[model samples]
Target chain A: MKKINIKFWFVGLILVSFLSCSDNETETLFPDAPANRAAQRNAELLDLLLSQPNGFKGVYFTKNDEFGGFTYYLRFNADGTVDMTSDFDTETAVESSSYEVRLGTTTELVFTTRNHIQKVSDPSYQPLIGTGFKGTSVFQYFTNDNGTITLRDIRNRDSGTLVLTPANFSNFETESVASVETSLANRDAFINSTAVTAFPFLSVEAGGNLTEFALNYDGVRLFANPTKFNDDGSIADEEFGIAFTEDGLIISPALDVDGVLINEFTFDGSSGFEYVATKEGVTAKIGYGNAPVTPLDAYAFGVRATAGVFNMDERFKSSTAFNNFYDAFAEFLLNTYSVVVGNVVFWDLNNGGQPYIEFITNAGRFWWDLDFEVTNGIVVFTPTGNTNASAGVTAIFQPLLDAFIGAPSGYYLLNTGTYLNFSNRTYSMINVDDPTMTINYWDFSY
Target chain B: MKKYTYIVFAFMILAFAMACDDGSDAVGESQIDTTPPILNDLDVWLRGNFVSPYNIEILYKWDINDTDIDRFLHPPFESSVRPVAEALQKAWIEPYTQVGGENFIKKIAPRQFTLVGSFNFNPNSPTITLGLAEAGTKITLFNIDFLDFTNINDIKRPLKTVHHEYGHILNQNIPFDVTYGEINPADYTAQWFNRSDAEARELGYITAYGSSQAGEDFVEMVSEMLTNSKEDFDAIVESISDEESKGIIRQKEAMVVDYYKTNFGIDLYELQALTEAATQELVN
Candidate 1:
């Protein structure tokens, strides 16, 4: 989750002595067992107030009149941080710091969220720190009452009577769409993973009736909000909302030009994503992140120095060549992935918050010592525990984990015939013959 | 046999003589094929596990034998069947057997249990019947698919439903004190779900569902006492600000205890503790 950023240096000086409340730093300890039955009931109430409700876990809800009357949700994960999502849009305002759940009074449950903002439009930015929250929010639970629970925004006076419903079996412990924050996060990861942000214009196939035009088009800015750039000069704009799928990338509906959205941009990997507005006779291949060094400079997919395909404008060869070098290369990469497991360059580990990978296998459900790495656009599991013949399995699946860990972007690791992990967090095997299969994923690191 | 034949022939002749009738009546036909739907292994398990011990039958498969044919309902998921059965065993059946003896339940328990996956909702009246005990013989429970066996709250509510329905069954068999209904009879309304719990409690009812009627109120009071600890029940009674409402709740609590003791030879408080401990295993 990202954090909110405002002009906080000056604001901090002004309110340095403001946040000195005794309840600010609450204990994170689980309560001890109750002595009697009545105490047991009290302890149960406290437990619900404290722990992540089992099965659709780490999902929290809040309502505020900050933007009129709207209800937003927070995805409080295993990291103890909260991701506050917008009700009107997919924009998520994440907590600047971690949140804590503490007993406000004998009866009330208080959850505090510090200010931070990670625009749902942009998933790449490191959240900026904010001044503070507007005011404290209060949550209370009542049984056999009007509703199961409620949250009141003390600042805005918007009261939300919450209904946390239990989902069915397969959805157990999975991210919920009803909890908007996690849904957006999950959606963003999927979209960005499919290289949505990578494609700016993609490909334009023009055939109806075309005329020659000069290629002086540098000042044409497409997406809004200049956010940041990686060390390799990759741009991260805060206003680019995307939806990625197995087929192609889906841009926000608002990006449509005259009711023609470049909805399906299939990045064939050799060239850039090829997009065409239907009936427009305009097909163009797009590239990722920032615009080219020069407006007319050719943008190619990993092959800029050699002979490449020309970026066409009207009936003219306007910009750089997009080489067909990766077309056969992408297919070749998919075929020998099992062999490429040991050939990985590096494992980019998710360092903070101890995000676990549940390896539910014949090796006997290892969860304690776990880590994840994203390399070549695929997620992989790396557990410290040795899992092999001792726990009762013939062949070790460490190579498979290596393959999954090294699976590049837009590819996932499954046994011989498994479908795409639709939620994407979970990975499983299709072959019953394989000894170890099915790994449940909980990604605390963005 | 000869005398009967002679009488029959004389009667037939007399009837033929008296008949000035045209043949218009047609006999009602029947679809007479009698291959019963093959009951599966769940039935075999139920017979071995429940029926042989207590003469109880468990039905989880779709059966139109005695159901409302037009109502939309489905069977529990195959995976949920055993977990639900185990939870039923742990929470309801075993506790009763321990407290009231094996013979006690064998003599008085419902003979059949029907499980459904979804709630039986009535569109005309906004009420969903979670459990129904029919004539002290069968108890039907809905939403078994949603029950998470590891969680106490999930198991407790169904057990509460079982206990409440069984209370009704017991009432039907031996009946409660008539004065139990005569305590506070004015606020009983069929539209009980419309009112809030606070409003219901203020009006001298334990829950909104209890305010449905005197009969439901009695069972609800009994179920609450059996399922909840003394402290929890005391909190509810104490939370009611009105003194008269408090007094009424106390009276209902006393009558429930008396009903359990005088009829079943069971101490209500001890039963509550036992039930609480059994359920605590599911959660803790």
Candidate 2:
């Protein structure tokens, strides 16, 4: 989950405070109202409130006139957005709503979307609207504080207070999508660069041991010539050459020299040249005149350059190439368990506040350790223990831990203290002789 | 011939002696036997001792045969049927009387009835197969063979079923203020059989099979509510999807509240809380 900006709350508080004091006649009581009194007041209040990073990070409590009470955590961001999470009896439902606080004689806080407002009050309590009851009703602001706000109930007598307290923002953990994209791009680049060298090649050869030659062929020249003759008494000019025509040479019908057909030869930029007349070809030097560079080297360089650009483009364009890696990593952490076995104890660690499975032996007591990496939304656990252990240990703990970590929703690892009455039971350890056993239970009051 | 004559004479004399003995007993007895069992009037005696104010009508139907008894009732014994009868009496019938009062039961009487108990022998079927009120008569019991008097759970099952069916009877007699059309507009169909129980519960129906129609769902909810067993009902609620289930739960709750308020003049929520707490105790 993204961290909410603090400016939203700051602006809200400033508007609320200004509205609360606007009714006071302090300026009018003196003489002619000071020029720019309202503007000056606004600037000073804005500076004081906005200068300090404002955030509404707290648990809110409100009792509906009909539906009893509910608690929610409201997080106000600097971008004028609020994230509100309500933990109902069955599951936690979350909604995001934007608010615009209007400062006048009275603070007017208006929710931008009416649908976002959950009418906490029971419908029956309200007067019927046609066949059914009214869906929503609003309240006026009565008081405001750093961590709490009280709203004046127009429909009821007593003022309803909405208390806000700091909550563990880290609890709302979700995987970040950006990190996955970067890693995939890097992988593509490495593959493309290595593939250029092994690209398939083809070549040709000409006549005899004229070891070097230079001529202007296709606006370029080369000066290496090798000449040889076949056993058939036909001259085999095995040489590399640059062709002036786009369709260089046809190897089917042998090229005739003075109306006498010599032999057939294929051309490839690599392997220099070969004699077509010889059953087991002979090598010859062939060169293109004034050629900028070898065809093979030029093509290889171009391939490398294209590969580099392709990688760059992929890194920016394809989210799957990089983002998938992070997504998979997050998924893996959610599913696996870490088992740590010591000489005496074994520990199995998992995610989602589940109890750590602890096993004790003569050597020590092992427990499952849970650690959350909030920024990455990853939970890591290492199953470390005595290396020289029986296979039974792994077989016993691994599968059970795996099932717990992979269980679907509604399966939560709540603190045992929440449901189990610990005061009634006696705690004991197996290996340790000490009779005095201590257990630390968590209290999730907020 | 002489031996035959002697035998015939002896037979006649014996017959005459037996006749004389039968006639002499009435003349010999002088005392009027008035003594009852140590736990005299046991049915009334037991009812008086218990604090439960529910007047359970135990209808005895002797139509069940031995074969049907074996199939339906565990431990197919005449003596075993009593416990099941008693459990149904206490769990549902008695509780309804206590909550709704004797007048309520009277309005729906004949409070208790008995059948020949020979025609039907299966205890489970006798309890579930017969409709509570058919053609203006509420048939509480059919055959004793269909009930396992010893198993408290089995006894409670029919009792709950009857109560649920009775709720329907009452609702039909004196219409509830529930605007059923507004709650759900979709028509129930045979497609309901394909759905899981959770889906039915989420739709505010008691069982997935209840989605077959509005009437069946309503009856199921009533039955489930009266039985007050979380094991029987909580799973149905939990299995429901979040969005669709909430509406169903709320609707059921409202209907229950309205039923109690309009008819029984009792706080339904308070009663529900009590019933829920009791169910939890039984489960734990």
Candidate 3:
């Protein structure tokens, strides 16, 4: 019995060992090794990225609710390098850096080096300060259809979506970079041009749907006050950020007017400053008109009143009627008291919501409170009282101060034009009674 | 029974051999990359100049893993990397080798250097960090992209950081007298940034940052002395108002000089002179 038991025990041990070392059926579940599959996927994704003959064009929104979207052109090389350019800044200069397509939880495309795309995500980028532009350098494959590849930021999937399409290098060169540069130059010219202070409002008609966008001052934002009230018993204003592309301009968060989607518009100055947008065999022509589709007086002035102080422009100081009045006063002050008049600014929602006008001078800044009303298309100002800080300077230049603060009619807040950038525009404050006594001021909120 | 045992043992061996065979002979190559890194001209120069000689690895490319995640930083441009590296070699390494010993940097120095293009801006603080030395093994220099080689002050800024951080490495190797901290313990404060350099000098410190702690105080003295000419350092010492403060600073300076002599047999003043000369030559 003992001999038989020993033989049985040896046989059982061998059986268990063989069973433990055997490969499981799990190998059949996957046709190829996980490592090899991942490597192949990485190669394919890289090939797809480099397959574009010219390059890839992409649009990215820094923040869903904030400054709209930015356009980027990128060319990927197999040698772990990438060339990138953007429409955000005037430089539009191409930047070269390294990139990698590697497998993580999913296939990821990472900008591994400092480039234009990385700058949007860099907190050290000056414009955004500590928060940056709320962008990301690591992107995961989202979709590939109809020659367009969509990559979503892995870290901030909800922040924005970046869609890439095969781009012709020459088209981007001529239409986007050169076009953006031209638009930028024109933007600067528009701001400084005194000949035409009035900018035309854009009327977009898409799929038989008509919507009007008033080109806000600063030249990049289009504002539309609601004609219909919301369920909350409040009228909401829709605003979109606009930027110049290689061939034309793109309006971020493509507007969904009724059922028609209208976002991108092409502009060719060959037939005047005309813009057109097309989608699914339907075309939308954006025509410019002198009068705003939506009246802007109450909306514009009301927003500016509470936004921040309006800084007086040098144009105001140099205008004939206003300059004649102020230059003599400035000369008198400089010749007699040796105190120079610097500039003047208007502030609302200051001093417990009381409107005030401040006269900045070489000696110091002085302020006098005023009562103002935002009427149909203008503001009427009446100086009420002077503060202790203004008492001394006000005693010397009370007449000049009163003339600026107490014009016959308050200033008509007129939109001069918009810039290629979004959010803010420039406005000229013309004396309602005397257009020559005009002051073109910038919004000092930023 | 012995014959039966032999038969069982033979069968067991046969079973083991069968268990080991999986029937597949195709060994897969390791998908993990074993390839050498692609080196540009700047990288080749760095390897030849710093790596082969001193075992130093200069990282000028942007790698988020190599930096503090909370702070905003970037990699130095290829154009900016070589100039700063050359400056470090001329001003810091060559001078130290000449003054201390030929193998001074090769044996006891940071093995890795990280170059950053932008200033290391702190989110919570108003100040920006120019450089950081980690555990005597690594040194990260910031604002290399902004360095104007023609400007003496800008050139001194990073060189000062190198000397200052290296001072800490030396201190780690052979600590300064513990009594050094007791010299002005009452003056050290966490709120050093609130105090101006003039005020710190009046309180027996070379810089406001030196007033934070004893280790920083020693390093700041090393940095300030090495970066500035002997005349400038003396002028600063003389500018202090209180006679008692001046005496205390003189005492600290004496300990520093003595620390080098008794510990490493190095003339601190000679190293400082060589450093200053190298730095001046660099800008000129």
TM-score each candidate: 0.37, 0.27, 0.72
Q: Give lDDT tens digits, candidate 2, residues A52-166.
A: 2322322112222221223344555444444554422222344554444433333433333211133332221223211111112233455445534554433332523343334
**B22-82: candidate 2 lDDT, tens digit per residue:** 3523654333324341222434434453323434344331222311322221111233335
Worst 10-residue lDDT window, candidate 1 chain A? A314-323
Cα distance off (Å), candidate 1, residue A116:
42
Docking class of 1: incorrect
Deviation of model 2 at A100, angstroms: 86
Judging by lDDT against the true structure, name the best candidate: 3
- List ranges where model 3 is wrong by over 4 Å: A2-24, A27-31, A60-66, A77-81, A93-115, A118-127, A130-157, A160-163, A170-176, A179-231, A235-243, A247-377, A380-446, B1-21, B24-27
Most accurate candidate by TM-score: 3
lDDT comparing candidate 1 with the true structure: 0.48
Model 3 chain B lowest lDDT segment of ten: B69-78
Q: Please tell me the TM-score of chain B in candidate 3 relative to the true structure's chain B.
A: 0.93
User: Cα deviation in Å at residue A99, candidate 1?
Assistant: 50
- For model 1, residues A331-416, the per-residue Cα lDDT tens digits are 44346432111121111222344443333433244332345443432334455563333443212334334333323222222211
* Candidate 3 Cα deviation (angstroms), residue A94: 3.9
**DockQ of candidate model 2:** 0.00
Question: Which one wins by TM-score: 2 or 3?
Answer: 3
